[model samples]
Target: MHTTPHPPTITTVAVPPGSAIASALPGAYFADSYETTDPDPATSALQAWLSTVAQVPGWTNRLMALRNRLVRLAGLKDLGALGGDAAHPLRDAASYRVGDRVGIFRIRHLADDEVVMGQDDRHLDVQVSLTKRQPPEGPPRVALSTVVHVHNTLGRVYMALVVPFHRRIVRTLLARYAAR
Candidate 1:
């Protein structure tokens, strides 16, 4: 008999004390994380799944639209979309290198156990990490973390406005399945 595999469920968890992701961005103004138990190839599976969530949700797009209009008024570049330019430099996560772009983040470090990516703009510097921890005899746990460091008043204001939606977005993205 043939059967389909069950998908993993993501959950919000307290940041592991002194986790690398939290320290990735110095003087970070915001940080959060989510976790799921995955199997072998956890890092790759998580990477594949993250590629699908770059654009975020429709409601988020609407909010981005409003943000674009307002930020433009303040002479900030209109960050066209959440996904960034994945079509050119980064078509997929299957063949990404340490310097490649993954959605809006640039890969700072990559490995079988973890990936560290971030972007530094005039407003802020943000870092993200996806890690897989395999135990001796249990399902592997995958954790995704984000840290943002504000560079100025504008950055602080921008983060303040988006913090609420950011958590929800992260949860929504993680609730889905990782690639098989």
Candidate 2:
């Protein structure tokens, strides 16, 4: 459970303006970014993304299960369990491809510094990106960003109900990854 010498915190930042993700996903009703100091420049975006997801805590998964049950009653998709846990850890997870499933999301794009993945449903289309950057004079940093385009009133209501909890859950997840 060792942490980095740098601040063990993740900062909520603005999503890169006019980024490609934004260009492709215009009219997004919701978008946000979270950043953390990433010391290792060798880490691939897919690795960072998978490792971060693997950090999802048990309570969060439980909450998701409850959410799944409730949402299913509304005819929403049952997303199943969240991610790999200690009991079922993700060791040497590979097969990173464009169409592969990464938890509830699919691999949409993979690059050296960023991997973009998310779910597209009748209600909304979500695109999530995990990017790593190496500034000139400081330790490297990693960022996770999400952009959502809602398709209808159902999407808006669903987003409204989820956005608040979404922020808290994402902060908790990113903080856990930052601690690593």
- RMSD per model, one decimal: 4.1, 3.6
List candidate 1 stretches off by more than 4 Å: 1-9, 14-22, 39-46, 49-55, 84-90, 178-180
lDDT, candidate 2, 52-135, per-residue tens = 888788888888889889888878887666574333344454666788777777778878787888888788888888788876
lDDT value for model 2: 0.77
Error of 1 at 128 (Å): 1.5
Cα shift from native, residue 120, model 1 (Å): 1.2
lDDT (Cα, tens digit) per residue for candidate 1, span 1-180:
999866567777755444556566456688888887654453463364465355366886677678779988988766555555435334656677778766556778776667778778789888877777765786777677888888899999989888898787776655543433
- Give per-candidate clash totals: 0, 0
Q: Which residue pairs in candidate 2 have backbone atoms (N, alpha carbon, C) closer than 3 angstroms, thus clashing?
A: none
Best by TM-score: 2
